[model samples]
Target: MAEERQRIRVEFAYDGGPYHGWAKQPGLPTVQAALEDALAMIIRQPIATVVAGRTDAGVHANQQVVHADIPADIWATVPRNAPLAPAPAMLRRLNGVLAKDHPGIIVHQIQEVPRVFDARFSAVRREYSYQIADGLARWNPLYRHIRWQHREELNVEHMNIGAQDLLGLHDFLSFCRPRPHSTTIRTLEELSFSRLPDGAIKARIIADAFCHNMVRALIAACVQVGAGQRPPAWLGERLAAAERTSETKLAPAHGLVLEKVSYPSCEQWAARAEQTRARRDS
Candidate 1:
C-alpha cells in the first residue's frame, strides 16, 4: 500500500528582488525553486508547493501562503534532535537550509493541515499594497527596492476618487495581461490610496483574485489621474472598453507587495475550494 500522506500549510514572506518570481523556472532562480529545494533537503525527498498567489518578478510578499503534501512517516521524523514538534522542526530546518543560500526568503509558520485546505482555491481574498515616493523629497535610497520613485507628485484624493469606479465585480481585461484559459473577471473588494507619515503614497488593493498585471496596471491608470494627466472618469471609461490600451501602462513590479491571503474556517475549506474551482472551470 502507498504510504499515508499529510498536508502541510506554510506561511512565509520573501523579498522578491533576488528571485525571478514565485514560480520555478528552468535555469533561473525563483522563490518556489528555492523553497522546494530547501524543503526537499530536509525531507530527503522532492517536494512541490502550491502557492496562494503567484506574484510577478520583483514583487515582494509580506505574507504568502502555500500547501504541500508529504509522507506522514517522513514528516514525523522531522524533529529528530530537540523536543520540538515536527512543524516547528521543519520550519527551523528549512530556514537553516535556506539561510545558507536563499536568505531573502523566510518561513514564518508551518503546521499539518487538513487535506481539504488548498492554498490557492481555498483562499477567499488577497490583499496587496503599493508604495510610491512621489517627488525627490520623499525618495529614499534605503527603500528603493520597495517603493516606486515617481517624478510627479500624486494627489491621494484624486487617486481614491478614481479607484472607486474600479471596485466591485467586473471584467478587468483592460488592466490584465491576457492569458490563455484564464479569466479576467475579478471582484475588486477594495482600492484606496493614502499618504503615509513619511509623505509616501500607499495604495491598498483587496480582491478575490487578480489576473496577471491587473494590480500594477490599475495603479498606473490611477496614478495618471492623480497626476492630472487623466480625468477621474477616464478610469471608468477604460473599464467599459474591456480592452487594453496604450495609455494604460504597467507600474513597476517592485512597488507591489502581496500583504495577505485570507481563508475561511477549517470546516469551510473544502466547500470554498470546490466553489472556486467550479467558478474557474465555468
Candidate 2:
C-alpha cells in the first residue's frame, strides 16, 4: 500500500548558538537537519520540513513554526482513545527525542492540519525584535548570546524618529541584500523602539516578508541616526534611493530574534497561502 500522509504543523524554540541556521546544509549543523533526522528515526521514513521563517546563522527564535507531512501509520502509534490527544503526544515525543539528541532546540507545538497549510507562504506577518545596550546599564554578560552589547552612545529618540519613516509599503531594495529574480518590495508594517526595564533599547519590526538582511540593514541605519552620524531624513532618502548602499551596515545577526509568525484561521490557511504566493507590485 502506498504510504498514507498527514500534514502537521510544528512550533519550536532554539538558541541558534550551536547550529548553522534553520536550513540544512552539507557538513554543517542546522535546525532542519536535526529535526528531520529525529522525525525520520521515529516515523521510519525520511521527512522534510518547511519553516515559517528561515533565520540566519546565530539568529534566535522564541517560537519558530514548521510544517511536515508524516506517514499516517507512524502517527497512528500515538494513543487516540486513551485520553491523550495525538497532538500533545507527538509534541512530547518530539521534545523528548530533541532534548536527548539535540542540546539547543525544543519542540512545543504540533497539530494535524489540512494539506493546504504551507508554513512559509501561509504566514500573514512576521515579527522580529533587535536588542541593543548602548547605555551600559543593560549590558549584562549573562545574556551575551541574546542581546547586543553596543557601548556607543545611542540617541533612542532619534532612532525611533528615523524608524517611523520606514512604516508603510515600499520597495526596500536599498536595505536588502540583492537576490536575483526576487523583488525587494515589502510591506513594512511596524518599526518601533522602546527602552526596556533593563535599560536596553529594543526594536520591534513586523512585516509581510523580508528580503535577506533587510532588518539588520534597517537597524544599522537607525543606529547611525541614534549615534548622531545620520539625520532622520537620511533614512527616508535612502528608501527613495532604492539601492543597497554601504552607508547602511548589517547589524550583527545575534541581536535579532524571530518573535512570531501570524496566520489566518485554520479554515483560511489554504486561501492565505495562495494570497501570499502571488507577486506584488505595491
How do all models score by TM-score?
0.98, 0.94
**Candidate 2 overall Cα lDDT vs. reference?**
0.87
- Candidate 1 lDDT (Cα, whole model)? 0.94
For candidate 1, write residues 1-282 as lDDT tens digits: 977999999999999999898999999999999999999998888999999999999999999999999999899899998799999999999999999999999999998999999999999999999999999989999989999999899888988988899999999999999788888899999999998999999999999999999999999999999999998888999998999878779999999999999999999999999999998877
**Candidate 1 ranges with C-alpha deviation above 4 Å:** none
lDDT of 1 at 233: 87
Give lDDT tens digits, candidate 2, residues 61-138. Answer: 898999999878768876545567777887877787888869689887898998999999899899999998885666
RMSD of each: 0.9, 2.1
lDDT of 2 at 201: 86
Alpha-carbon runs more than 4 Å astray in model 2: 1-3, 78-83, 280-282
In model 1, what is the error at residue 109, expressed in angstroms? 0.4
Q: Local distance difference test, per candidate?
A: 0.94, 0.87
